[model samples]
Target: MSTTDSAPTCPVHDFNHYAELPYGEKIEFYDRLRDEAPLIRNEFANGHYIVTRYEDILSVYQNAKTFSSSAVTVFNPNPTFKWIPEMLDGDEHRQWRKQLGPLFSPKAVEGLEQKVRERAIEVIESIAVRGSCDFMADFANQYPSFIFLDLMGLPFEDLDTFLHWEDEILHVSGEPEETARRRTAATIAVTEYFRTVIDARRAEPRDDLISKAIEFEIDGEPVTQDDLESFCILMFMAGLDTVSATLGSTFYHLATHPEDRRAIVDDPELIPSAIEEILRAFAIVIPSRKAMADTEIAGCPVKAGDMISLPLNAATRDEAVFDDAKEVQLDRSPNNHIAFGAGPHRCLGSHLARRELRIALEEWHRLIPDYRLASKSAPTEAGGQLGPSGNIFLEWDV
Candidate 1:
C-alpha cells in the first residue's frame, strides 16, 4: 500500500474500525486522510481505490462517465435484495432517472412546500410547549418522515414502520445475525406495502407522488409497477433519513455555536446562506463509487471495479477549498460543497431537503427563541449516508 508523507499520517486501512469512531473523532481522521492522501488507496472489507481530494471530489462529481454511481451503496455483495435505480449505470440509469426526475424537480417539490411547511410547523409546535426535547426524535425525525409519507400518500399510521425500516437499511452493524434478519424483514415488508399502494393508486389515482409515478410514462408507455414500487422504496429511505440526519447535525452545530446561531437568528435572510454553510460543514454522508475501468485520478492508479469510498464529510472541511473551512461562517460566499454529492447521480431531493432545513431553522428559532443543550452530553456519529444520530437534548424557557 502506498502512503503519503504529510502532516496527518494515514492509519492502516481499516474502514470497519474507522466506522466505529465517535462523530467528531471520525471527522478528524478523515481530515488527516484528505491532507495526506488526497488520492490515497486503502484496504476495506471488499476493496479500495483512490479517495481523491476536495478538488478531485468536484472533478469526479462533474465527470460521472468515468466514476459511475450505479454501485453507490457498499454492501457485502451477497445481500439478497437492492434498489434498482440506485444500482444502475450509464443508459439504464438515465432511463430510470428520466422516469423519476419530474416528481422531485424544484417545481414539483414547490407544489408540496405548503404541506411540508404545515407538517414542519405541527411538529415544531408540538415540542415548543415542552421547552425540552430530543430534537432528533421529536422534531427532525418526525418532520421529514411525515413529509415523505405525505408526498408518497402513504398511510399516516405507517410512520413507525417507515422509521424502523429506514434505520435497519442504513445502519448495518452490531449483531450481524439480528441485523440481517431485521433488514430482510424490513425489505420484504416495505416492498409489499408499496406494492399495495401502487395497485391502489393505479385503480384510483390521487394527487400524490406514488399516483403520479404509477401513471407517468417515458415515451408512450406507463412506468412499470415494479419500477414505481422500487423508486417509492428508495424515496422513503433517502428522502426521510438523509434529510433527518442532515437537519439533526445542523441543529447540533447551531446549538453548540451560540454566536453562529445568533448570527442567523439576527438576520433571517441569512438562513439560506447559513443552510448552505451548514450543509457544507456537516456533509456527513460518505459517498462510495465504483471505478468503471482501470483509470488514474490525481496520480493514483484505480483498477476496474475497485470500490472507492469518498469521505465527503472530510473533503468539505478541506482548507484548500474553503478559507477557514472548519469555522461555521453563514456569510461565506460562493460555497460549493458536494453535500448532496456530485455527478449525474446527485441527490434528486436536494431542493426539498434544503427547503426543509430552512424551515427548521427559521421556525424552530422563532418558536423557541431561547434554547440550549440539556446538559454537556456529547453527540453520537455514524458512517455511510447517515451522519450523526441519537438525541440532541435541548432545554428552553416555555
Candidate 2:
C-alpha cells in the first residue's frame, strides 16, 4: 500500500532492494536515495522508514534501547526466527557478545593469519595459473568457506553443500512466495544440520568454535539448545557470506580501477587501508531496528513497533561525514566508517573478517597482481540485501 497523506508527511520512495541490481548501479542507487532525503518512508515490501545520513544512522545505532533489534529485516517487521546475538538486546546481547568475543579477538585472528594466508595462496595459485577464472567461485567463495568450516570443525568436504544452503537462504531468487519457501526450507536444513553437530559436540567435545560455544553459559544458565542452534545458524551465515561478499565488491573495484590495484600491488602494506576504503565505499549491510517506543528520527515520526531500515552504504557515503565518500582511496586514513555496523549488535566476526580479507588481498596481489574484468559487460550480481552475492569473473595473462 502506498502512503496516504494522513500517514507521516515524509518522503516516500518505493523500491525493493532485494531485487537484483548490478553492483555498481546499486551503489549509485544508494547515493541517489541518500541525496533525496535524510529520511524516506520506503514502501517497498512491508513499508519502513529509511535513515540515510551518517549522523542519523549513527544515532539510531547508538541509541539501541530506543531502537531495538527485534526485527533486523525491513521486509519482515516481526521476524519468525532469531539470529542469536544480533536479534538479542540489552544484557542478553551483551552476554552473547562477551562469550563469543574472545574467539574473534585480534590476537585470536592473528594466530590464524598464517593458516588464512596459506588457504588464500592455495586458492589464488590454482586460479592464477589458469590465467582466467570466475573470481567469486574459484577464490573468493572457496577461501572463506574453507576458513569458516575449519574454524567450526565442520567437514571441508561439505563446503559445497554449505554454499548451496547459503545461496538458498541469502541469495534466494524467485517469485515472492517461492523465495519465502526456499528461504524457510534452507533455514530448516541449516538448523537441523547444526542441531546434529551440537548434539555430537555435546557427546564428544572437540577443540573448535562449535564445541567451545556448546559449553557456554549465558546469564549464569547453560545456553539452551534453541539458543545454541540460533548461534550456529548466525555463525554459518556470517562466517560464510560477509567476507565473501565484501571480497567480491573489493576485487570488483580493484579489477576495474587499475591505479588502486597497482598502488596496493606496489606497496603491500597499503592493503589494510585499501580494505578499509573498499569496505567504506561498498558498505553493503542494511541493518534494521524496531522502535521500542514512539520516537522522532530526523524530525520524522516513528511509532513503537515501526521497523527502520538503516543502510550502511548510505551512512558510509554521506557527503556530510566523509570527504569524497564515493571515491575509494587506498590510503584513506582515519576511516571511521561503520561498514561492520555500530553499537551493541556490531558484527562479532569483524577481527576474523579483517584478517581473512587482508590475507586474501596480500596473497592475491603477490601472485596475480595485474588482472581485469574477463568480459566487457559487468559481472553478474545476485543478492543485494546483504551485499552482492558473488558471480564476479576476472582474468589476466598467465
Candidate 3:
C-alpha cells in the first residue's frame, strides 16, 4: 500500500497521451496498455505511472487523500495556474462544489433542455440543406458553444474569439516553448476578457451564470477576483471544449457504423442509450492525479509527489468490468461506465453535458438522419485533456 526504497518495478511504456494518433488507435493503445501490464511508467515528460485496470483506477479516484487533485495534468505536474474547483480538494473543494451545485443541478439543466435543443436544431438546420458541411465547424462545435455563450450571458458575436482562445489554451501544438507561449498568451487573453465581464457585472448584476457566481462566497468571505478569473478560465475551457470533442467522437462512430446510425434513426428512443454506449466505447478523458503520500496502486509503487494517470477509456473498455466491453451495444442496460468519471470529483456538469449530447443527437437525427464522412476530405483528431481535435466533416443527401 506504500512505496519504499526497494519498491516493485513496473514495465516502462513510452506512451504519451498528448501525442496525436488516429482516434481508433487511441482506444487500441489503451487496450494494449491494459493487456500489457497492470500499470506502466509512461516515459513522457517526467515519467508517471499509468494505471490501466478498472478497479485500480477507480480506487485512486475514490481515495483522493492518497492521490490528490492538486495536479490534474501529467505534462505539467506542477501547473503554474489552478483550474478553480477542479484543482481544489477537501473542505475547500466541497464548499466550492456546494456553491456551484445549483447552477448545474438536474433541475437547472432540465430547465435548459429546450434552449439546448433549440440551439442544436438551429445549428443543424443551417447546414441540413447544404448537403455537405464540416460537422465540427458547422454543427458540433457551434451547437454547444452557442448554448454556453447564452448561459454565461456572453455575446454570440464573440464566439470566434472564444474559439481561438480555446485552441491556444487547450489544443496548442508545437515545440515545447512555443506551446507554452501560446497557452500563456491565450490564458492572459481569456483572463482579461473575463475581467471586463466581471467589472460590468459588478456595476449591474445580470441574469447569467457569471452574475450568479459573482455572489458566491467561501469561508463567509466573498470570492476573490483571482479565484473568479480562475473559475471563468476553467468554465471557458470545460464549457466550450468537452462536449464538442465528444460530439465529434459520437458522429465519427455514426458515420463509420451505418448500422448503428440506422438503429438510432429508426428508433429515436435509443439515442440516450446509444450516446451512453458511444461514451463508454470512446471515453476520451485521461485524468491525472498527484500523489499526496507514498503509495502503491495494484502493486505499482508510487512515491510522494508522483503523478498517476487514470485513463477512463481503459476503465470503460475493461473486459473484467463489462460484458462485451469492446463492442458498442446501443441497448446496453445498466451501463455503469465512468465516462463522466467516478468519486467525489466526478464532473459537476454531467447533467448538462448528457442533456446536450442527447438533445444534439435527437435534433440532428430528426433532420439529417443519414450522413457519412465527406468523400473529399478526411476527419482529423488531436490528443490532449479533451480528446479529438474536431475536424470531422459529415455530408448527407439533401
lDDT of 1 at 133: 88
| lDDT, residue 149, candidate 1 | 80
| Candidate 2 lDDT, 1-398, residue by residue in tens | 22223135477877766676666776688798889778888776667888889999999999989999878876667777899989999999998889899988998998998899889888888888888887777777889989899989999888888888988887766566778788889999999999999999999999898899877898799999999999899889888888888888888889889998999999999988999998898887878899888788887777888788898999999989899999888898889999999988888888899889999998899999999987743554445533333556788987
Q: Ranking by TM-score, best first? A: 2, 3, 1
For model 1, give the RMSD to the true fold: 3.6
Worst 10 residues of 3 by lDDT: 1-10
lDDT of 1 at 346: 79
Off by over 4 Å in 1: 1-12, 17-20, 50-52, 76-84, 175-182, 218-220, 384-389
List model 1 lDDT by residue over 1-398, tens digit each. Answer: 12222123323354552244444776767777777666655655554643647887777767777776666544443334446567656776777688778877889878877887788788889898887888777877788888888777877787776787877766656544565577678878889988888888878999888876776665567777777777788887786688888887787787888888888778889999999998888787776776677676675566666666776766688898889998878889989888888777777788888888888888888877677887844566655433324557888887
Taking all chains together, the TM-score of candidate 3 against the true structure is 0.95
Using all chains and alpha carbons, the TM-scores for the candidates as numbered come to 0.89, 0.95, 0.95
For lDDT, candidate 1 versus 3, the one ahead is: 3
